[model samples]
Target: MTETPETAETPFDRAAEFDRQVRTLVDRGYPSLAGVGPEAFAAAVAPLRDRATATTGPCDIDGGRIPFLLVVARGAAPIEETMPRTTLHRGRLPGFVDRSFEPGSLERFVVPEEIGLPDGDIYLLLDVERGEEFCGVVPGEAMKTVAERKRTPLTIEEGVALVTHFPEVLAKNKCFSLGGSRCGDRRVPALWISKRAPKLGWCWEGNPHTWLGMASAGGRSAG
Candidate 1:
């Protein structure tokens, strides 16, 4: 079968790529979580729509062409609520919080002061990488590697956003850790395929799981 130009994969098909992202979010009910309807939420993202790009290939530690991810800030849509919306194989997985954390534990896992994030209810995460290489490395060692490469690790919200927008990226045996957000402790939050569904769980920082890597991005921009 011959592939038409529209059907063929391109690195930068601006309009089609951006529209697909908008549809993905709307389908996953991100607009409702942001206190807006699908149309309003998409309109809010229109100003930055032209800047959207697709992840055509792999990203390296030094940086590469990573896709731009549309993120609803944690403040706007809490992880607990957004997580359950995540789906895999038509099944919804609960966003399980580690029992070690208190009831309000998520609030304590704020974006580090050093990482200056965009100020808004919604924004664009540039050069987002799934951190496949860091899979076998411990969270502690992965942090050093991420820092050495001049990249910021992803927070819990960003992790949810990544999986929400790109479900195929959260494959079994290739889930990732949200090492960016921490509560001054060693517990690192992660998203993995649990019981054939996507789950938000945590792992110890010093421990290395062969299936988990640390997710990161180059930086963030206001949407």
Candidate 2:
């Protein structure tokens, strides 16, 4: 009998793939992800692996419109010319504790502290940008102060990167390249609905990968 390679056995070129996806998004008119409802948000998320099983819940707050989830192709790479610190460092997000998130309540979309929530929350996982910066909140675990690589969900920066790099004053819903001057790609935020992995850690899920802004996501607006 011959042994076959596992489906995931082959490593993917995450960075290259991410760049490709961004390019595609640019060609597609940069649709806005701001006002989508639960059903629509559900459709945005990337599905879990066939063998994998997990529940997803929607973050359908703000009446019906969806919030933004920013992403970048290269999050973990050190600050450089092509990729600048302004993007890796500056840029605004919504909030740490979701506005709709109740105190002491736990949900996949809610922060991972002060409460435990029931199942069925959608946490989108982008296929590209494996090493980009981002994170996720476990169902009911105490959020560790620091990430332990693969185990923690996403760093605030990675998630911010996904956000259309925008200035604090501008509240329009669009996905601008972190370094728009260089990338010259600006579109509505790329939408990816996410689900909670019961027993899994951040690394295993493979979200935006970066150590920036790991201390606490409360630095600026992270809503």
- Model 2 scores a TM of 0.21
RMSD values, in order shown: 4.3, 19.6
> Which model scores highest in lDDT?
1
**Tens digit of per-residue lDDT, candidate 1, span 87-126:** 7644556445445567888898887788868888888887
Provide the overall lDDT of each model, using Cα atoms, as 2-decimal numbers.
0.75, 0.24
Best TM-score goes to which candidate? 1
Q: What is the TM-score of each candidate against the true structure?
A: 0.85, 0.21
Candidate 2 Cα lDDT to native: 0.24
In candidate 1, position 211 carries an lDDT of: 92
What value does the lDDT take at residue 108 in candidate 1? Answer: 87
